[model samples]
Target chain A: MTIPLRTPDGRWRLWPGLALIAALAAGAAAASGALGRYELNVLTTMLCYLVLAQAWNILAGYGGLISLGVSAFAGGGAYCVALLASHTGAGLPLTLGAAPLLGALAALALSVPLLRLRGDYFTIGTLAAALALQAWVYNWDFAGGSVGLSVPIARSPDLAQTYLLACGAATLAVGAAYWTAYSTFGMRLRAVRDNEEAAAGLGVPTVRYRLAAFVLCGALSGLAGGLIAYQQIAFEPGGMLGPGWSINALLMCVVGGVGTVAGPVVGTLVVYYLLTTLLAGYDAVSLVVEGLLLVLIVRFAPQGIWPLATRYAGTLLVRMRRTA
Target chain B: MSAAVVLNGILLGGLYGMSAMGLSLVFGVLRLVNMAHGAMLVLGAYLAVLITAGTPLPLPVAGACAVLLAGGLGYVLQRHLLTAMLVRGANGPLVATFGLSLIASGLVALRFGSDPVSIPTALGTAGWSLWGLDVRAAYAVSFALAGVVAVALHLTLSRTRLGAAVRAAAADPRTADLIGIDVRTLYALVFAVASALAALAGLLVGVAFSVSPQSGTSYLLIAMAVVVLGGIGNVLGTFAGAILLGVVQTLAAAQFGGGYRDLVVYILFFVVLAVLPRGLFGRRLT
Candidate 1:
């Protein structure tokens, strides 16, 4: 499942991926003028998802946690930052700093006990944490309870700036994912993912690596959540901490390719686009489509779209070499 | 605060324990983390709601139909979808079941809408007083039913041929196959039984409280927490864990205001995980 990004043959598939992202960003920018407010909102949301999906990949695909509580981090970031911003005069910088910091602290605190939970237990524990957190947030008066907290800052109603900022965040998120995936740490992460016991037996410090991945994922998701609060100008506990967010992240990674740098990007785009475009008018259609995609991918394409494509490409290359 | 409140908690714990038992059963046999177990419970409630809508059928019959519908779904999915994923080892079924859960949720939402619907029952309004505490008959009935389900499940596992097959499958899948037991069929049965249990729990809840599309996650979380805190695949452990949770939540609500119940539950879960990783009853299934 190791995708060959660099080789003696030097196919350099990374360039094509970067080019595609750049082109999409540029195209999105151009469309900002022509697109309606509704369309812009969808695109911006897609970027928020991009950030979330990538962070989730870092935790589940790379690290062996398979956490179902990434939304906890995101929602924590959203509420923490939104509340601070509205209540204080710290502005966006202080709010943004608190988002990742609070999220990281939460990760550290949760992971201490949570890291002890492995596999399905870990997933369930994280989910319980998320649900509990959501309930807590909903009941907290400071968080605006069920009514949600609205940001006091003014912004363009057209959402062009928000979409553009989201694009940049998506790019950076993908970049961070690529950097980490190609690093030595990433190799260890894959090793851990493949077999934690085996990796630990080989002195892989599985717990530490897993914790690091969780924190990284949590921070990124928190940042995304903060950004979303900025864009939407509201931080609803239901919106941030719901199972739907977790599902979307898992769907994106699984559909595009789990354990790959580019997988979440592609998966998020496809899933988000399908929901916003193809199933635009239908109610509850997104859930069905995403659910079906997850089941199908887990059943049929556990290696995901990227690995499948590379396998086909390898076979094609072999055939070409034979002909030559 | 009084005998009835404590009694009510105990009764609710019965259903909670019953709700989580099927989940424990599935995990024990298939080694899958079915995130949709709560969704299954909700589906059961939905089925009960649908069946009881303007029907002359007795409450028990409607409850049975709900359980049956859920059991049927479990059989279909286990026989068709989940079995394929089981061949690949642990994580396959875990992810697949999660996906199935999402799909089920979507279907339920699409069919039922997001609105909360309560099952109308005269028993819910009826109650008895004992030791200066008020008690609802509906809660008591649901609780008693849950206890029966738990006892029945335990007997089935310990006494029945199918129970033996399931245990054999759980103990060693390949060996079970070698012994001429249909591992596939056993899993399907396990799923059916689990689904039935979930539906029963759901039906009980519908009669007692309210059912909605969004309520599944809370039930699922509590069930999973109970499963983990009880022990990964231990049934008796689930009963203990659910009761422990029921008490913890009820007490937390009583003390810290209802808002902090979750905080307390999570803290309790964390403490259990930190202190006893294998849960309070970590005994390996015999």
Candidate 2:
């Protein structure tokens, strides 16, 4: 008997997935002109959140690195765009292009000290880094101190352009996630996550894989932040580098389903519509609801809504066939 | 910096040590980082504030009540909500505690209006001069209280049979359970004790400084710094580390500006982590 080296689900579906994604992106772009300003803004925000959620999913779900510092990269990217636009007279495309590079560099610098810690220590380290970055920004006169700086509106992208940028970033994020879902790189990353000692015994370079994932996550988050900056012309450090960004990304991933390609997309849509849009202006109420949802989900539905729903549907299908 | 500033820093360090003690204890025993720790601290402060404002009880009595209440809440939470999640995985409890923190912060904000508030005390403006050094009366009392608590905790963990059981359970829960230790109940008790310690620290923090709904994360960061510097789970080490951090922060504040003190401390924390991941004192129970 021949033994299969990989699971049936491990087959790469990248080409078809890319085609579907491209079609969706094209459709969204076409519909953007018809969308009202409010709807366009909301959709743009959702897309940016989608990018962040996907990045966080890859790191925490697949890499087993639960980071609470998404804001560091996101805010760093936003600041990069803001600084370039305001001081260097960089146009939108250049600023956006430079944002991810800055984010990748920052991640590289941080991974030296941060990646040394393991598990919860790493999580706490990331939180510290995020908070430290926020504090530093508050004191940095070059970054406009606590008051924060505004990107020059003339050089910034309009709402439709921002939406298109967000869409492109979201598509890239999803594609990356899909690749990670099926690629050999992701399989090795998961092996390292599941058992570092075992993976190392198999000759996997654990640190290198983790560093790559971290930098990729940072780069994607930075791209999302650039889109956010374009969306909000007058951005402050508090709004940009806030814990809210981390919380939102975490909530989306946990609520949708971590470690799955479709999880972030579903999560972003559900969270944005259910908590953010429905409970707008009631910050305290929304926070309470979000917290409650997170607690209940982890306690009862730890696999998250997407995975749970899929499993339920699978069982239902089997039950129907058996009955028939 | 002046000698007075150093003295104040030492006093501040005492409070910092107290704030971190519960977190260290819980982490040491349960191996679960209570992300809601800062919120619990703020909750204690708010409880004390409410007790003083609504009732004629003395501040000391009110503070004790707040501590007990917080302990009870912690026990219930760990027993009912956190116990099952513990087996799920490392990320499970961490995420759950984070959710709890959000809930706590949101509730506090809803009730307290997000405005800064402080515990009203005669000691707020009172000062004491001892051995040619000036100290605030509140700081002096808080520092003494922290010392007493630390010594008591150290003695309890090392000298008592219950302490022995707790230590065994912490070292190996499966083995301890096989030996007839009710690890679940012990976990809850340890969590309760940690929460009480956090509440005590919170009360002290309220007396020494202003607190708002949003103060939890900042205090949590300070406690994390202390925990890391003192060596995670080391009670006395945490106390000493807090003092060191306090001194350095005060000196930095004096050199740069008050606004950059947090930045300086955070950088120091990162440096310490990079240099000594095991912490300055290394991890030990006492």
Candidate 3:
């Protein structure tokens, strides 16, 4: 018997989009050898956030669970290296390898209690928990307190290597998103998001799917955090676990195209470029603009700018050519 | 540990009740979370602080003006920005409010800097005794005011014709609209009232404790707990939730430590939400 390997909606057509990102990453790697120190750092940080946005997309966009507490998982990922350095003096590769696993464990712990809260309560619950954990981390000496943990300099990756590592993670993240867009697992997540009751009635194992998504997202976020730790060399709790990181991910995922494979990637690049150019060195102005931009996008383009552009781009281009 | 702590807890809860009231009311009527509610409350406190600090206005007078201005601001927001958002869907409004909060906090930070700015009033520090319990003058006043506002709101919801229209809309907006009750206007009025309540709570919180530009998020967290605990949309239940939370917090603080209060409160909040999400007195949300 023949088996179907695609979602009924022909989501596989976007596989080319995945290949395009792969090609771009290859191009970015080849060009990174000649880039300056500042450009290297900026690009690496942007790629880390790109991974975060893609991770957030899987949870909120596909699984229909919104969380602003992803920093907790990211923090878990970062601390893997920190803890190892403080206690065991593990090298960069080993510490980085442990991040996704630690992050998934942290997410699993968070989800058991978090998932029990229904509907909108999850939003506030996760936020409160994250903040509480942050505060607790400030007091706990074992976790390096609020001063935060440092990666041992001897084991740190160089700028060029860090950029390539970030590129690797970004590729994995985008691949995950692309897989979700076309795979049965992603279909179940989308189903649970659209209507939990109906999906449950259809024997979709909604909670399990949701838990799996949360864990996977958490692991991905952890990987991003680990990459940042390697890059920054010594990062603090405020820098890593602050609401700023979560807010950036939210802005990128929503504005780019929530639930679409290319949305978070597009959103990430667009927002990163905008922040660097338009609101550089102006924290207050950035907050104001980001907030306003987020509101406008939600109100004006609920499905997000990238999705709308994709829908209209072909027709608009054809019409322009005809007029010309 | 003592009656004094219990009294202090209840007094502190007064502000939380009103803070949650605004969020609960909007949720009841519109079925949407007001992510900007806390920012709106902070804005109210800022207005009160500005008038009290910069102008020659008395604390009470400044507070009153803040309340009225906030109510008017609520009307404008509901009628203009939110009305359009609400028509889109539930999630759209959430993101919209989230954005509103970001803008509000950013503006506050830009205008005043991130320093703590309290009402230049001595209401919280000034103390008095009644029935062998020590009470701050401001806390006493707020506790009494909470009583008055609670009774006023309850009576309005129960007895007034205007309130009846709001209730009808909350119960079933489509039916109320079909019955020619002007659901949109009712929603606008409800939002205004809720916003005013939030501002009043903000004013009280500023006096009883202290308010800063960034104080919005903590108050918002507590409000969510109160709303969740008492039930979403039930006014009296919100106060009940707030009172319980206050008692729990103070007790936790006394027994464990101040740092543990948030740990305890948030854990309890999560546990309650997990166990009985409808709240002790709230209706089924879904």
Candidate 4:
């Protein structure tokens, strides 16, 4: 059975969808001024996670490259902002501007080696790269060693501003995902993901397509990291470049739905609220619940909650129509 | 670098090899990268520590119990969880195991606290001089134990009916099943044996080096490096790869600083994976 894209009729709907998203994002940003500090903080954090989840979805869901080292890019971006701010006394705009570039550059360099690995090996390779980056940062005196570095408070964006930046980033991330969903590029990518050999045999540049997705995801992850740096102010390698980032991204993507454009958005909200907000002080319990959820999701709903819910809803609609 | 450091590295490699063997076995048979392998090792270590510290049991007895328990846990995990996941697709087992690792580590941390702990034994601190090179008693014992296990495992796989069945199953599950071989039972048995080996390695690691609940990831990375270097599913090659990794790490630490050791290993792992996906040993068990 050939499954069609969400909008397979034409690209005409893309313009309206883009405009609607822009309006919604602007509306959210404008409405954020009325939110208290706690609500703002939570929303900002969720937005950042939305960016991460979306970025991860682009790579793993569409690209078919299950990277376990997303922290490498996210941390790389945060470090870029931190170092730029500290060393050159760069403004927030400049620091944020450089973050995605740094992330993209790093992905480009690593892609040569990383993209060579296939399937499970690729996952292992990305994981090693992240840990290696962390270990290197721990020993490098230039990057403040294990003590970590702080973003210049004077140059940093305040909570409200950080939220705006995160909103913008999340919008871009979602836009990217939407584009990948309907565009010919995304179709080619899905083709590569579904069957590399067949795509290659059909003369698709599989490696190039995969690399493009990898780099694009890296850029988005880095932007999210930059926003995180602005929000946290003082961050360490352990917190920034830790496995937690990868875990969070993976959990959000898997739980929501893998490969679906709307999955990460739903996943980010569900996971952020269910695990982070509800179980704030209970670290162990949170982890246990998170793990159990992951296992259960993969076992029972491997296609993820988004797809499962939609499928069930479709069936229910069919039954109602038949009865009518 | 002193001769002693290299000697110590070789000794440490024995434990690394033993730890990696289980991971390799699972990957070789099930083609599933058990992301919980390191967690299983940590669990083994914690269980041994709990038994020895809370009870009057000797360290050896505690170690044996931990191994047995780990094996049983592996059996259940494979039979119930992983066996079902295997049919779904590739990502199912990987994600499930990742979740399992999280659960294992979280549970361990909740029970034991996050602080690093080790089993204090005379062997841990005692030393012996062999040809003017100092070797810790724990290292020596672990190395010897690893060698013995390797030899025994080799013999079992090569010289027994069970070994033949396992080999046949690994070659092709469907074909073996058609020929009256119970592939599911054999898989569980293989996973159990692998878990037992990992537990043995964990016990040695606990005695020789401290382990915390979060130590599973590092151990998992080390096991992955060794498995890749030794060639996946090649048991003997795993031992050799572990030794090479140990030597490389030790030398890198000596050349740079102690903090850079993991950095070097991870870099090496990435490079090797990119360059030699088949592994340095260039051997396939199946």
Candidate 5:
């Protein structure tokens, strides 16, 4: 129906927000072109991760599936594009389109079987799936095995356009995540997440909602994967399916507050800034720091920084009202 | 392919069973999946290596000493670090254990410099052949040690007061506390036993193969799979799951080479999760 965005309180105060987002995207794109190539590449990686992590939030944070294998799905999409690009005469656009579709297909296949698990079993099952997928890619000689396949360098001689394109993809993903999280279906998903048995009793079709979240999560992660493939211009199985991406997604969701529209964005920016500045060139140290961060947040700030901020904001509003 | 291979798988499964028992025990008692369990195993292995480096004591004695050390460390960790964080929620334990895992891995990396180390054992070049199948001395020793550990564990769990207290805590901490069981003491003892078991598994692995900082992850994953497959909160179930996993792994390795071995085991794990969400050995085993 091509409906415009509608927030939680269904007010017609959306045009300004859209305009602001559009301006911000434009500014980010322009800044990328003005910055150094390395910085631009880092920004691209961050944007791609933002999309992937936010998409995973749809399932893990909202629907409460907590899949730790998002990188596996992302890697699957990357390998698909790499293999297809090598064989066929497809362009970047075609690769981007097919990557998400293929990822969605994989999700559909895995979800039918995986959705049956309960509690931590589901999480572990998904992790096992990720590990197995990595193993498959590692040994599957046709996909270049563990060494991975390389993407040809961009011959277009235009860095600005590529930066803009990546930004656009990221913005599109954010919009998709926001829309899905705010829609009526999203409400049903929340109901399911809150109490699956109760939701099922209320005829919310809990399994269907979960499967939809899984599919959406898979597609968005695939888009991010395709973007990453283009940005790196290479695909490596070990690098793509590594636990770092999984940990990053978890960190983002936990820090930003899962089940919120702006949580992942905030989480990503915080984590990315910390990684780029504070913990640069120290992989083991960073991992320990990250692990500590996760433990602290889960223990002391389970509601996350955003949700806490929101609560304080609400309190401030109430104080102003009382004073008036 | 043959009885010997099945027997070997069964034997190896015994050790895997032992590896997973500690993790399962902790999870059952606390409902906290310790992400650092593998790190504990590595810590135990390294401790064994350091203690018996030039000592005339036999490898088993050194292994026992390592277990005691690991148990003591585990007691301290549970008393100090874990108790504070465990009250929040299930995810609290997961995250805390993750942090502990990082610390353990980093500390080991710092101390050991990522070098692979093996405990010196005197069972070199010895084997018993049955129907023309060669069984190595190391495998025999590993299997025997594993069996001893498993039997001892079974006896401890089934016949001892401490084991009864541990089981009570595992079943219901609140109820156990109401019945005058000191939960703090039970938790410490459970952790100590679990860590000791991890250390024992580490010693077996070290002498049978080799040990390094990076080796813990693979063992951790396998232990988790075993716990999940056998159903959580049950020691015998862990044993059964471990043996099943061992057979699956060895067969997969023999059939598809090392690359697909893990892949096949993981596929089975997923299948088990999908079909029997409660695990192959459900709560009934506990």
Candidate 6:
């Protein structure tokens, strides 16, 4: 019966925030029609990144699980859809529908072993699992081994349909984030994050809450993977399950203000825009710079890259107002 | 498996034990996983490779210098960078170390051109036949090196006053400080020791196997699995775990082929984590 607590200072602005997000998504969807195929594909990938980042934020920022295995879940989901589509002659609808659940199941099984660990142990364990999964996929015969599988739909999805799908998923992901950020469930999760022993003392089922967050986040990551496979139409398991995917998603989350509802969406836009626009031709060096940026950001602005940006923006706004 | 496989596995185990010691030591003393450990190991190998390529110095001397260089770098990193991060809390250190790993890997890639490089030491091309089993000279040398390092570290921890101070600081830093121990210096020393050990392993790996800039993740993963299997912070247990893992790895590779070896090890690790969360010989609850 408890409504979400949106602000630490106890304000109720969840609905308005969600409405703003909905409006932004609608505007973006409308804008997509005017974009060329190349630009549309770029936006679609960015949307996928936003969803993935949101999923990561939910687990690490809110649930206190610093998991390094996002790629595993995403790969699991991608493989499920790809396999179903290729082998059983399943349509895109059925394969995509089952994708997230399959990912959820894999994550649930993984969590049994993983959730038993905490702190750095958990991080290490997850990292091990991730690398192992990648290796497994590389060796698995049915998953196409190193060559990977191409998703063959009975009817190929057009660019517009794919764009819409990504937009819808991103919107849903952001909405889910907003709900979690303000919902009583999110509050309980935060309580567990801040002080698990105290939360347990107050009768919170910390384990269950954590498991729920893990599975939910896994499902989100998995769906993003599925969407990537679907959009690209052909993908290697390495691309989906590589350390790069996890690192990119992690960068986005940290850059955007982890645990904030709009952080992932905003962060995704800023990072991808810079990567695609400013550093488009400098891929190799940009990667090195991104890695360094991660270190500098963690050291200098542990709160996030966006939070620092917001501070400067606020100062500028104050100065402009004063001048006016 | 054949006797050759068993011998090679045992030899491999020695290397694992040697590397895992540094990782295990840091966990025992500082309670940080040292994510940059793998990068440090690769950097050590790269340093050895680069120095030997440019200089006429013997492999042994260059290796020693590499280890010392790694130790000094570790000391500086801990004192200068990680100290401030530690004050923010555990996550700060974790993220910061991860960042260091990222930077190390990127720098390695930029320098090494993403290509695999091996040490050109003569041992890599030499071997001996013991009874009916073939023994690679590099593996045998690495085994001997691991034995020497492990015994030295073990004796130091058990018999030395400095070791006593480290154990005391590890057990209770605040109390150790109350009792007049220099806790900060101890942390720096432990970090340096851990990094140096990683460098030693890196040198061994460079001689025996090939390494690339991208090898950091795999090395880190192996180090983690060893530490966990051996028991979180127990050095002796880490040795046992490394031996067990080395044997299992050889057996798995023999049974399932080469490509499947990592898969087998990882799945086994997950199974172990599930069934025995504390690890086989773990001293710490984590």
Who wins the DockQ comparison? 2
Q: Which segments of candidate 3 are over 4 A away from where they belong? A: A1-18, A320-324, B284-286
State each candidate's clash count.
Answer: 0, 0, 1, 0, 0, 2
Which pairs clash (backbone N, Cα, C closer than 3 Å) in model 5? Answer: none
- DockQ of candidate 3 compared with the true complex: 0.67
Candidates, DockQ:
0.67, 0.78, 0.67, 0.77, 0.51, 0.64
Give per-residue CA lDDT, model 3, range B1-286, as digits (tens).
2898888888767767878888988988888788889988998888888777788988889889999998998888788888788876666777778888889888888888888877656666798887889967876787677777777877788788887887888888889989989988777888898889889988888777777766787788889889889988788888888888888898879887786776766787778876786789857321
Between prediction 1 and prediction 5, which has the larger DockQ? 1
Give a tens-digit lDDT track for model 5, residues B116-147.
88776666346777567766666666667666
Can you give the lDDT of residue B97 in candidate 3? Answer: 84
* Number of the candidate with higher lDDT, 3 or 6: 3
Which regions of candidate 2 are displaced past 4 Å? A1-10
Candidate 4 residues B100-157, lDDT tens each? Answer: 9999889988998889999888888899997888888888888888888877777777
| Model 3 C-alpha lDDT per residue in residues A1-324, reported as the tens digit of each score | 854434597545556667787898899889888999999999999999999999999988998887777788787788787788658978777888899888888888877667765646667776786777777777778887878888887778899999999999999998898888777899988999898899999999988999999898989999998998889888777767777778899999999999987888889989999887888988778889999999889877889989899879988999999999
DockQ winner between 4 and 5, please give it. 4
**Candidate order, TM-score descending:** 2, 4, 6, 3, 1, 5
Tens digit of per-residue lDDT, candidate 4, span A1-324: 844324666444566667777898999899878999998898999999999999999999999888888899999999999999999999988889899988888889888767876678778777888898898898888998899989989888889988888889989999999888877899999999988899999989999999999999999999998889889888888888899899999999999998998898889889988987699888777778889999999988998999989999999999999999
Tens digits of per-residue lDDT for model 1 on A1-102?
986667566645455566666777777777778878888887788889999898888888777567788788888888877788777756767887788788
DockQ, 0 to 1 scale, candidate 4: 0.77
Error of 5 at B201 (Å): 1.4
lDDT of 2 by residue, A52-78 (tens): 999999899889998899999999999
lDDT of 3: 0.83
Write the number of the candidate with greater lDDT, choosing between 3 and 5.
Answer: 3
Candidate 5 docking class: medium
lDDT of each: 0.79, 0.89, 0.83, 0.88, 0.77, 0.82
At residue A241, candidate 3 shows an lDDT of 73
Judged by DockQ cut-offs, is candidate 2 incorrect, acceptable, medium or high? medium
Model 1 chain B: lowest-lDDT 10 consecutive positions: B1-10
Q: lDDT by residue for model 2 over B50-148, one digit each (tens)?
A: 888889999999999999999999999999999889967789999999899889888888888888888888887789997888889888888898899
The root-mean-square deviation over C-alpha atoms between each candidate and the true structure, in angstroms, is: 3.7, 2.4, 2.9, 2.8, 3.7, 2.9
